[model samples]
Target chain A: MSMFWIHFKKEMLEAARSYKWIWVPAVFLLLGVMQPVMMYYLPDILMMSGDIPPEAAALITVPPPEEILASTLSQFSTIGLLVLVLSAMNTVAGERSNGTAELVLPRISSVLPMMIAKWAAMMSLLILSFVLGYAGSAYYTSQLIGTLEWGPMLGAGAFYIAWLAWIVTLVLPLGAVLRGPAAAFIALGSAAALTMLASLLPSHLQWSPGRLSAIATECLTGGDPSAWAPAVSAVCFMALSTIAATLLLKRRPLLPQA
Target chain B: MMEPVLRIHNLTKHMGSLTPVKGISFNLERGSCTALLGPNGAGKTTTLRMLAGLLSPSQGEIRYGNSGETGADNQRWQKRIGYLPQYPKFYGWMSGLEYLIFSAKLSGLPGKQAKLRSLEVLEMVGLQEAANRRISGYSGGMKQRLGIAQALVHEPEMILLDEPVSALDPIGRREVMDLLDRLRGEVTILFSTHVLHDAEEVCDRMVLMVDGRIAEQGELSELRAKYRQPLLLLEVEPGEREADWLRSLPERHFIEEAEIRNRAARLVVQDMDEARAALVREMADAGIRFQRIEAGASSLEDMFMKVVGA
Candidate 1:
């Protein structure tokens, strides 16, 4: 096996030992399932409150299955993204501070492969958690609400995953320089700021990866958002950050400043 | 004649305001255990870090290979060396065997071979019994032995250890020292320590550093002969007569330097016979009660103190 695989496997083992693999996916699955379940029960809940008028009950109709799934994407944008940032905050920063990087970095020689392995390991967890949660949300939406097409659902999930990946990749470069919580906070803050800026002037900033969430919503709700631009931008952002993170790690491979 | 496995030329590191190693150069002969001896803050750790590529030198080149040939850049040559920092921290979640295997694999050993070598080294470091236990549960000495095992797992040509036994208790120190003694001729070992005795215990050569400078470096036998000096130690009864005599001992032409305390003195003498005779004569004339008097040669500890104090 290549050195990358070796490091990647070690990461996976650590995730397993720390229960990140289990808890992260479980959190997302609950979030995804909660969205559709609440949508179906909101009208009944309003009626049972007794302070609500009959007219309010009639106005409260359940949203479509696609809309429920899209709303689930919004749920992910808040809690899901927070969970991801928290879980991955220490991937590099903790290694350095805990002094494990001092032991491992010297043996590897080049920092690039180690950085890439870290990215790949985090990606595996991210992809697994998102897919499992999206599937849970989709299953409930189809059963409780209405029929949905698989093609649009997959496309929507794909675009949103790319957006999530942009934020995830941002953590690495930041973690290479800063402490864990600081890196996580900055990454999530930048992601939120970028999303707001992109939405404020959609036509001017449509190329930003931040627009991916809205594009995912559009795809699910049966509107065609622009293609190839945001996708290419996400790839470029990841490439640049990986190189920058690798260089940062090489410059200060040890914690406590050696 | 055999060439050195590593040649360090002008290895220097400047950490902001202070320089740790100042253009120090030396050659590490193949299969020789050398100690980078220094006190705290003398830049021993910094030199080791630069050698391990954990820190980049401000100005210097670490040519890692034989005397007549320089093999590769830092990145390529890193595989030929293993390193253990002062306090090596392993993944607390990983078992001893798992951590060693991870290190071996990262050094480019294949899966099966990495496993075999990891197990082999675990046994070598006396960690085979605890190979399956988490590193968090290990005692201080066990952790250090595991650190050595990780450095040796890949079978690197040379191992660089920074203060390997300084952080350990006496038993742990002995364990590591014994292990190092067993490894002396098998690999080229360069380790740093503030304790001269630790260096003398296992190392054949010494590189003494003082204030980031190479104060002295040479083979053990050569240094012992070159720095050989005779000394006289005397302990007299506490009295005014003895005190007055000890005060005047430094003025004697035969005594080079005299360090007088309450009722005792350590004199570095030009001629042991002449100084001993003069001291006995002065004591009898002064009517001082002498407890014990001994003539001896100064050890390397004196050399260390004198060089560093200079």
Candidate 2:
């Protein structure tokens, strides 16, 4: 168990030293800061136009900066998803390609600990990025539109982001078990295919990890916390996927001689 | 008797239709350095990897003799085994010290202990000066040394090094061999190499593999004694026609090929003493002035070829 923490700490250090933490959140911040500001000013700029037609003027609703900021926060939070995918791309694929996995595996006995440690480290980074993005937009919203209700919803939404981070963590074991980027793509693509399949099913079959994105959106819109059942299902998929990946890895050579 | 540290029974591996290693079995005693010697394409690497637990044999099992009965727990046994592959890469972003520390941590050491062990191992591999440097800046030899350092950091009871010195230059090879020499009393090492001199330098006993089987295996001195062949070559004065006269000697069996090579004559004899006695008398009687007559030392390469038939 201590070994897991040591590996996790080292992984976190590596991520920090590589400045991955800075760049992932910075990209999201750019999106976050822009989303609300864009929403707030675009209507005002259009209203100032002498060419504004009478019929189209009715469609323009100049929301306060807080509403604009909230809408912007939602759009930019999608960037958090991109950060998770980018991080996963490097987590398993880069290590296997560089032969670091071979150097690591023989030292450690079980694939479970190694994969679990790595997953935790990556999830920590993903959650950190999401919180930073939300906080950046929240600060802007406060300065521009004064205080508002539903500040607690931001915390719940951050937890939702964390649960999704755990879902991506499931990719590491599959990456380690299978060789190369093709395996990474196939594993992630399988999850995407599952999501698509669930979308096609009737509402009865819709309660799965596949609906996490929609569940996340609902949580952001001040929906009941109980609506997070689908995201909770995603956690179950994470556990099952991690276990399956470990077993699959045990069957194949984690490190073939160069 | 102290049980063998490692025991293998009928280990086999096949690549498609071709069997690379077929039912080869061997045992190693504690603190013994055994070299797995073979020509390229022989199953030496495959067998070493199986012992390292990096490769699974298609048939048969390898048991690391622990306290429990056979097939009880592999994880406990694996913890005691260390493996250094032929080509190992570190996390490029990591400093050499960080890489070693990470390896130690993976081997179940806690934070403080892992760092301490990593420092000791880096010093052991003569990389302490460069420990803070990124792994990407390290040369091939430095990377090789780091691989050794990482493998030994956990203080494993047994270590498998595949072609450890194969990438080193002559001086680097000597340094690595000297290091291995020092590790004699500390750990049981199973080193695999195609380089004959490396095996000759550090290995007490060796298994020469050929076509997925043990062609020969024993103490170095024993192999030397068993395959001893006494042959003498003498170079005579030019224009003396020593080849014809030497061939006519009663007790000497002449090598016509050596004789034809510029006033040189070769003699093959079972017993060196008897042949020398006969050659000296015949040379004096025939007034043959030869420059050299010396005993030939058989090399491991020669022994390998003779055992494996060319």
Candidate 3:
């Protein structure tokens, strides 16, 4: 426990010192603040260009207040997912490659602590990024659409956090078990592939936490988040993945002086 | 024996289908400085990593001995080991002090204690002045020193340095060697090196590993006494019959073997004093005019060559 905390605190310090938390959030915040503003003026910009054909104009029917909010949330969440996945993939594998991971394993309790500390620190960073991005989107949306009913918006916010948390958790084990940046890319690609497969099913299949970030934007606009029963089914998958990762990583020996 | 701080019995490690580390075993005693000398691809690094607990054996167990019976024993054992890898790459963006402190924490030291120990080890490895500088700015030697500092910050009972001075210049090698030497009698320092001089200067005892096995192991004096041979070189002019005459002197008493090179004969003798006198007598009796005869003590390189050859 002490060793785990020590590793965790050291990671936090490293993150702070490197200002890794700063850049990811700064970029996400910029995107977050711009999403609603862009959504508001895109129609005007299109009208001014006189390129709004009759068929295309049918798709632009002055998006409802709920749809506008959903669009803003999707804008922020999509980028949020990518950045979090990229960051998480490099977590343990990078340290392993750099030869510093072995220096500690021999001195510490077990590989478990190292994996846990890395997971915890990364999750903290992921949560921080999601919250900051969501908050920026919320603030920007209010300025454009004027007023947010704390209830529905908060529910949408909760779903976003849950979906992001689940994705980060799934990526944790892949990042922990594999070596190099390729593992991170593979995890992202797998998540994307899973989402595409899920989309082929009926609305009932679309509630997977992995699929929720994209679908929830529509759900927040009065589409049924409940219609997606796969979210509950995915609970089993995410839990199993987390457990398998822990077990495999616990036994995976640190690469010796090779 | 001081209870063998590290004990590896029949350790075998296989990577995929290739077995790089075979069934090799050795014990490390407390406060004894030993060197693992081997050529490249000889498994020196693999052996050190197994001892440090960084690598698990495919077969066999590494039982770390300490004063305990159960749950707390392994934990206690780990806190006493410091491992410095052959190529330790730090976060180049981090300052030297930041890296040390991070290592201290990872080694299970509390913040305040970690800070104090980091400072102490930085001074020990001569990185105190450069502690605040970015690791990227450090020269190769300085980076190695920082690695050493991080390895020692926890004040482990056993310090395993893998080729600690392999790439350093003469001065940096001396610095690392001096540090390891000073720690002698206080901590068991086992460092692997291909450089024979590093082993000669700092190690009290040594183990020569070849093809993942201990070829020879003991104090220098013991190995010298066992393998030392008095060799004499004779230089003769071109097309001289001196080489044939020297070979005809005999190989029983003083001459162990003889080899001819161009016009010169190289003799392997049993005793230096006896060989010189006998050679002179032989030359006088044979009336052979030789260019020059020179004799000298054998070196570690000679002993290493002989061992490897054997």
Candidate 4:
């Protein structure tokens, strides 16, 4: 148990020394504030671009505050997820590639605590960045567009975090088996495939982890949550990723072959 | 009646099509330092890694205790073992002190005790002054010392170091050797090295590996006595006639096995005095321009070459 905290503290210190805490939240802050501000200034910016006809500028209607927040999530789904994946891609892969695993592996009896520590540390960073971005987006939406129900906004944030959790979880296991960029690409690809499958067959894939994204957006729009399937799947998937990473790390050589 | 610290039997690792560390076996006696001696690609690293629990052997048994009950996947036994790779890498962002503390903590030292142990280990490895420096700024020798520090911080029953001094400069190698010399008997060490002199410097026993097999292994003096042979070394300038004459000298009846190089020959003679006298006479009669001739004995280096020569 103490070993878990020890590893976690070291990981946090690594994150600090690498300046992950600074840049990750900074990117999230930019992505978050850009949404509502851009929607509010869309007409003026479009008019200034001269190529747009007067009719087209008038045709553009600013979305509602709740919908604007949801669109911000879609932005996060793309570039924000990319940022998260790229940063985390090296977590396990670097340890193996750089030969740190050789020094560390023999000291511990089981890899479970180390894997759990890594997952928890990553989750802490993920939640921090997401919360900062969501809050920034919510604050901007309330100021520029309209008032929002704090309860629903927080609810939307939680569901969106759950969705992102499953995606980030992919990094741990993939990083164990593949190099950084390959692992990042595959995690992104898997998330895309699952999300697409969920959208294509919503009823059939109601319990799919990918449904967390839609559930997140629906939370903002006061959509119903009667099914309760996506939530369960998201938690299960997170657990599975943590377990898979530990097992893979155990099965394979700790340090990569020189 | 006491069991060895660790016993390996018929250990083999099949990495894809290539088999490194083929059916090799040796027992590590308690508190004994054994060198996993081998040349490059002779599987020293593979064997050490298996003992370190970093690589599982494809076919073998690693017995840890007197009962020999716990097999290869001895999860609980991992805490008792420490490993430092040939080139031990670190999280470059971490300070030396922080890395040691982390390693100590990972091996189950409590927080306060981990810090205390880390500091003690840093001083032990002569890195206390540079403990706060980030690892990225460390020299090769400092990093190697830190590697040893981390290995010792947890106070494991045994430590495995793979070519600990292989990548260092002369001074760095000497420093590590002296430190290992100081560290021997405190904890059992099984370091790999291709340099016989390095093994002879600190190791009490050695497992000489050749082509993934244990060519020879025992107490340093025992093996030295067992394979030690009175021999002859002859060197001649590389003229065609002199080279031909030196090669012909190995074919004499008294010569046992002859190892001929470009202009040199290392011969194991049945009778050193008779072989030397006859060879000198033959060279003088043939007018061979010999550079140097010495009648001596075999060292570990000679044995190493003979094991790998085939």
On lDDT, the leading prediction is 1
True contacts kept of 3: 0.74
- Ten-residue region with minimum lDDT total, candidate 1 chain B: B66-75
True contacts kept of each: 0.89, 0.68, 0.74, 0.94
iRMS, model 2 (angstroms) = 1.7
Between prediction 2 and prediction 3, the one with superior TM-score is 3
Q: Tens digit of lDDT per residue, candidate 1, span B17-36? A: 88878889989988899999
What is the C-alpha lDDT profile of model 1 across A1-258, one tens digit per residue?
376777788889999999999999999999999999999999999899899889778999998899999999999999999999899999999998888888998887678877888899898999999999999999999989888998999999999899999899999999989999999999999999999999899888878898999999999999987867988899899889889999998888775553
**What is the TM-score ranking, best to worst?**
1, 4, 3, 2
Question: How badly does each model clash, as a count of residue pairs?
Answer: 0, 0, 1, 0
What lDDT is obtained when candidate 1 is compared to the true structure? 0.89
Best by DockQ: 1
lDDT pick, better of 1 and 3: 1
lDDT tens per residue, model 4, A171-197: 889888888789999999999999999
Clash pairs, model 2 backbone: none
lDDT of 4 by residue, B205-297 (tens): 999899999988999999889888889988898899987776676668898888898899988998777887888888888888989999888
Tens-digit lDDT track of model 2 for A134-160 = 677766666655554465446445555
User: In model 4, where do residues sit more than 4 Å from their true spots?
Assistant: A47-58, A225-227, B1-3, B68-73, B233-251, B258-266, B273-293
What TM-score goes with each of the models? 0.97, 0.85, 0.90, 0.92
Per-residue error for A101 in candidate 2, Å, reads: 2.3
What is the interface root-mean-square deviation of candidate 3?
2.2
Ranking by lDDT: 1, 4, 3, 2
Residue pairs whose backbone atoms clash in candidate 3: A207-A231
lDDT of each: 0.89, 0.73, 0.75, 0.87
